[model samples]
Target: MPHIKQILCIEDDLFIGEMYRRSLTKAGFAVDLIASGDEGLKAATNKQYDLILLDVMLPEKKGTEILHALRGEGKDLVPNSRILVLTNYDQDDESKMAMQSKADGYLIKADITPRRLLEIIYSLDVQSTGAE
Candidate 1:
């Protein structure tokens, strides 16, 4: 049997967080849902998660800052974890910054469905694990 993947979902909105948690859990992933960037930063930096689904706009701290910190020197707890930025923003600057911060992928929240998001997660898993 294959190992069940662990996922961290950092979303501030209660509805969005629950939606991601439900979808990911139903897909057989062990998912952790955090409502604020502050809490997410601590969890993400201390735990071992296979993937991180992050929202750019968050309370206490922004997702981009978390991404930057994780990708920066001396603070990469889950350096090999795939990070996918899920946000409503379409701003080029934010996208550029996220890409520069080494985020694996970026997707607009309004443009994604749960099924498609699951597909993306699976694809990323394959890419990271080098599995068929």
Candidate 2:
């Protein structure tokens, strides 16, 4: 497989953000890690990333809102990208919202080990875009 470059990580936790950047960078992916949905959205307007790692809860808006913005085809903003939902809450409502938003994959923070996350990333199909 080709290397994964240009990753956008939209998570609020500083420690987790750093950890995700480290993980993706170590795996040869260039990462733009941010702490809020609003920041991520701004960056998306100018930067075309290969993948977007989004969190459910964000400062300005939820990941669902961001995902909706990215879904319509005219989104000539970002690169042909896929979104990976990374959140601690996998509750029914959260899952439904994510699925509705069409997230490419869902990773429940509490249930994932680092190695397991790597496996999930690798296993994802390149064409996978949107949620669930």
Candidate 3:
């Protein structure tokens, strides 16, 4: 059997977070859905996850701040985890470029369906595991 991957989804919208959680869980992934940026950051720092699905506009703290902290000071704690910026916010070029630089993948939430998200996650897993 293939190893089940763990995912951390940091999204403020409860509906969207639930959707992602249900989809990812149904697809055999263990998912932890956090609705606030502060809590999400705490979770990310406390636990090691295979992938992190981050949203931009969140309560308490912005996703960019969390990303910056993770890629900067928290890098050692999550060295092997892949951070993916999944946001619906239309950020400016500079912000987008900065996020892209730090993240393993940058995707617009509105543009991608849960199925496509799963495909992307699977692809990332394959690449990381060196599996064809």
**Highest-scoring model, TM-score:** 3
Residues 1-132, model 3: lDDT tens digits: 133388999999998999999999999999999999999999999988888999999999999999998896536456768888999889999999999988889999999999999999888888777752
The TM-score of candidate 1 is 0.88
Which runs of model 2 end up more than 4 angstroms from their true locations?
1-3, 72-79, 94-101, 125-132
Residue ranges of candidate 1 with Cα displaced over 4 Å: 1-4, 73-75, 94-101
Best by lDDT: 3
The lDDT, on a scale of 0 to 1, for candidate 2 is 0.74
What digit string (tens of lDDT, one per residue) describes model 2 on residues 1-132?
Answer: 233467899999898889888887888778898898888888876787767888878889787777777764445344466678888865588656645457678778878866677777766643353222
Q: After TM-score superposition, what is the CA distance of residue 78 in candidate 1 from its true location, in Å?
A: 1.6
* Candidate 2 residue 4 C-alpha distance from true site, Å: 2.3
Model 1 steric clash pairs = none
User: What Cα-based lDDT does every candidate model obtain?
Assistant: 0.83, 0.74, 0.88
Count the clashes in each prediction: 0, 7, 0
Q: Which ten residues in a row have the lowest lDDT in candidate 3?
A: 72-81
Ranking by TM-score: 3, 1, 2
Per-residue CA lDDT of model 1 for 1-132, tens digit only, reads: 133388899998899889889998998999999989899999998888888899989999898788877886646657658789999966688556745467889888989988899999887777766753
lDDT of 1: 0.83
